[model samples]
Target: MIAGLFETHLKVADLKRSEHFYGEVLGLELAHRDETRPITFYWLGGRGEAMLGLWEEAPENIQRQHFAFRSTVPEVLRAPAWLRERGLTPRNFLNDGTDQPMVFAWTPAIAIYFTDPDGHSLEFIAMLGGGPRPELGVISLEEWQSKL
Candidate 1:
């Protein structure tokens, strides 16, 4: 069985600025940091369950990237409110896109999309049970297995 994700490294043009935004505003705990090397990694967790990760090393003025996190339906709905208090805009998946949110198509699950400080698409979605299954991204069982 697969375990949870470790960390995601992002290259930020301004490390200090990204650090402040993620550490101060988002309130993620700094697991390891090296200012002289200018690399910092934040881990979001209480004991051993780390669900959030961040890095600052992207090139200057690059388009935002997307990263998704897992949560329960309630957490998916409530987290945005907390994030909004810190000035982070939460775009309901059901209300976004030229057509509609793909999240809704995956029934028994719910998700709320939002952007990070750098405009990167971040989604907190509830996967009914836990974690994501390959079928969640496929139209048919054959389509899912064929890729592998």
Candidate 2:
């Protein structure tokens, strides 16, 4: 049976710089690190919901990717400002031409997008309550089939 997800890893360009950015700037705690293996790991949250892992880059190209973290309003507010203070100005917190906080319709979540020092796109999102959840709502079997 599937239990839960423990962690995720990323191949960072510079271990030193990535450590400084994720550990110091992002306020993530350094849990375990091995200079010999040249890999570092950071623990996130009290219950370890997520982990920040860094690995040495190989000769192959490192493809840039994006990831999002679920957070509260306070965290959402702090993220943009924090990025700005560090001179990493985001393209925009909210989508361009919209006052909303870079959100999607029918989902009560706000997302913020920015790139890391190595040009990896990262996002932080906050979920709001009272939004439509398919599992929580009832639907007729015939209606569902018809829509599909």
Candidate 3:
């Protein structure tokens, strides 16, 4: 059986721009890089457990993918405003182009969705336990947290 997630790799369009997003904006550490060779990689989380890698590669068709970085409940709640503070706007899967406050995925995780520099869907999620599995895939964070 699989133990747990080790790492995830994403093909980014621009190394410098994507590095800034993941490094500065997201605050993941720059674990590895090379000055001689044309390669850029980053590691998130601890050496054991889970991690993420950013690769310097151009997309072929660029089928966008969604990934989430685990965050605290308060952080998930504050994410939209925090992103907005840096002039980065958050969005929802509904695609109405409005900054979604948060989403209660019925798995009972509170998530705040947004896109990276490469248009990859991303989220900060907090697994808040105990909630009815609603058929409505996305519920407002306020409504979910209010129930807590």
The models' CA-based lDDT, in order, is 0.61, 0.66, 0.73
Candidate 2: residue 109 lDDT (0-100): 54
Off by over 4 Å in 3: 35-37, 59-61, 145-148
Query: Using Cα atoms with residue i matched to residue i, what is each candidate's TM-score against the true structure?
Result: 0.66, 0.75, 0.81
After TM-score superposition, the amount by which residue 100's alpha carbon in candidate 1 deviates from its true location, in angstroms, is 12
- Candidate 2's displacement at residue 143, Å, is 29
Once model 2 is optimally superposed onto the true structure by TM-score, how far is the C-alpha of residue 48 displaced, in angstroms?
A: 3.1
User: What residue pairs clash in candidate 1, if any at all?
Assistant: 10-57, 11-57, 11-58, 12-56, 12-57, 12-58
Who is ahead in lDDT, 2 or 3? 3
Write the residue-wise lDDT of candidate 1 on 1-148 in tens digits. Answer: 7686766666566777777887898677777787667678777555356634445555664567787776666676577677778887776654443211234433435566776666777777665543445455523223333433
lDDT tens digits by residue: candidate 3, 4-76? 6777877777778887888888777777777764455566565455666666676674567788888888888
Over 1-148, each residue of candidate 2 has an lDDT whose tens digit, in order, gives 8675568888877888989988887878898899689789988764466677888696265678777766775676567676778777654343463222443323545566777777787887776544544542332223333333
Candidate 2 has an lDDT of 0.66
The number of the candidate with the highest lDDT is 3
The per-residue C-alpha lDDT of model 1 at residue 7 equals 60
Ranking by TM-score: 3, 2, 1
Assess the local accuracy of residue 144 in candidate 2 as a C-alpha lDDT between 0 and 100. 31
Quote the lDDT for 64 in model 2: 80
